[model samples]
Target: MPGAPFLRGDRVDLRTVTPEDYDFLLEHGNDPAIRHGAPAPTPVTREDLANFVEDDDESVQFLACHGETPVGFVFLFDVDPWRDHAELGCWIAPNEQGEGYATEAAALCLDHAFGDRGLHKVVARVFEHNDASMAVLDKLGFQQEGRLREQDYVRGQHHDTLLFGLLAEEFEV
Candidate 1:
């Protein structure tokens, strides 16, 4: 069973990641549609997932759940308290994509990031081909701050990576 939510939204609640979620995460992380956008598209193992869940002190990771069902994952990683900023990342299950879940979940995390954590800014990196994620970031008021040319080699081709940023004062909802 999932634990109590650390952050709640109208349709989604961001809860602490637990050991029980490994299988769900493993399946999604290894999915071709999902892995292709990842920085390293290498297969993830149980050990890798475990390490990610347990060893990342600089991240605030959560399972995005609807009611009692997990639908996606969201996190604020590479948190730099000294700099008052962090990188936001999220992924929805393929079956649950295009339903606004990613946007809702990410908004919830941004609330925590800027409100609770008192962050000045939050940034995200999206692959050039990830139109969905780019749309999500756009809806969340993230501006395209920069772009790296051919930054990631996905599948058999190189893709540009877009950098987006949102300031705490500029966030709404």
Candidate 2:
């Protein structure tokens, strides 16, 4: 279990992700607009995404909601307890891309990371072409850490990834 209870913000409420949410996760991740923002553009099969959702091994998967509607999913991976570092990823519905929901949800995640989880750092990777994602990480006080060159090959072309990380000591929260 996560060290704290579910977190919520003005625009979004975050709860533990469940198998029931698998269909939404799979469908949203495959949305054309959403796929374009991600570095990997492969077709996300329902079974594949379900498998991914099934592996919430660290109790880190979160389903973000807008009131009663499911917007999308977010989670942390690559947890190193000794190092207190993990990577976070999130996706909001194409229609819900703006209005600061992403930032709100991300802020809640960071609180869970630093406040409850006792983590020292949380990282995120955004494609160079995704300005909105970069802004959300920036608002959450994450700093650019490094660049992974040609880290992702999608549709016969390679794309770069920008890594951003937030340290507990560095966050204003």
Candidate 3:
């Protein structure tokens, strides 16, 4: 969405998430698809997001919009200035899944994190069962660094996580 001019694309629009995005955040947070990614209650109130976006955040968040409509959110975090490390994470609206939007948006974010932000490495840890996300990260050249056993407990069951990473020098595109 951000690659082209005016932050526009067929699948999404990349914009900053504002305090006004509370409604969208709440709706998406309760979404089953998003819950599968990283389950948490979306705060309906403005204060809910204030804790994250208030100051000069080392991390960055972007709201993914489709046309004039808001659809999802993406973020880059775990920014370590000393070691120059960061992590890439994203989530698409439930209705927008399996449409390649995530891949495209992620690529842009990764580029900015490593190329523009001067980060040396970007990492991601996805649930082992999330094949689609795993594929997207793989296509982006993120290698499987390790497998974390029982790293998460979600929906009343324990699941393993796959730690994936991509280095700045390793990016081909």
Indicate the residue-level lDDT of 2 in model 2: 20
**TM-score to native of every candidate shown:** 0.96, 0.89, 0.86
lDDT of each: 0.91, 0.79, 0.76
Candidate 3 residues 71-168, lDDT tens each? 66777877888899988888888888888888877877777788778899999999988988899898889999999998888878788989999999
| Local accuracy of candidate 2 as per-residue lDDT tens digits, 53-154 | 675455377788877677877777777778888889888988877777788777888788789889999989988888999998988888998999988877
Please identify which of the two predictions, 2 or 3, would achieve the higher TM-score against the true structure. Answer: 2
Give stretches of model 3 more than 4 Å off.
Answer: 1-11, 39-46
Over the stretch 1-173, how does candidate 1's per-residue lDDT look in tens digits? 77678988999999999989888988997888888766766888999888878998888889999999999889999999999999999999999998899999999999999999999999999998889999999999999999999999877888899999999999998
Which 10-residue span in candidate 1 carries the lowest summed lDDT?
Answer: 33-42
The most accurate candidate by TM-score is 1
Task: Give the candidates in order of TM-score, highest first.
Answer: 1, 2, 3
What RMSD, rounded to one decimal, does every model reach? 1.0, 3.2, 3.2
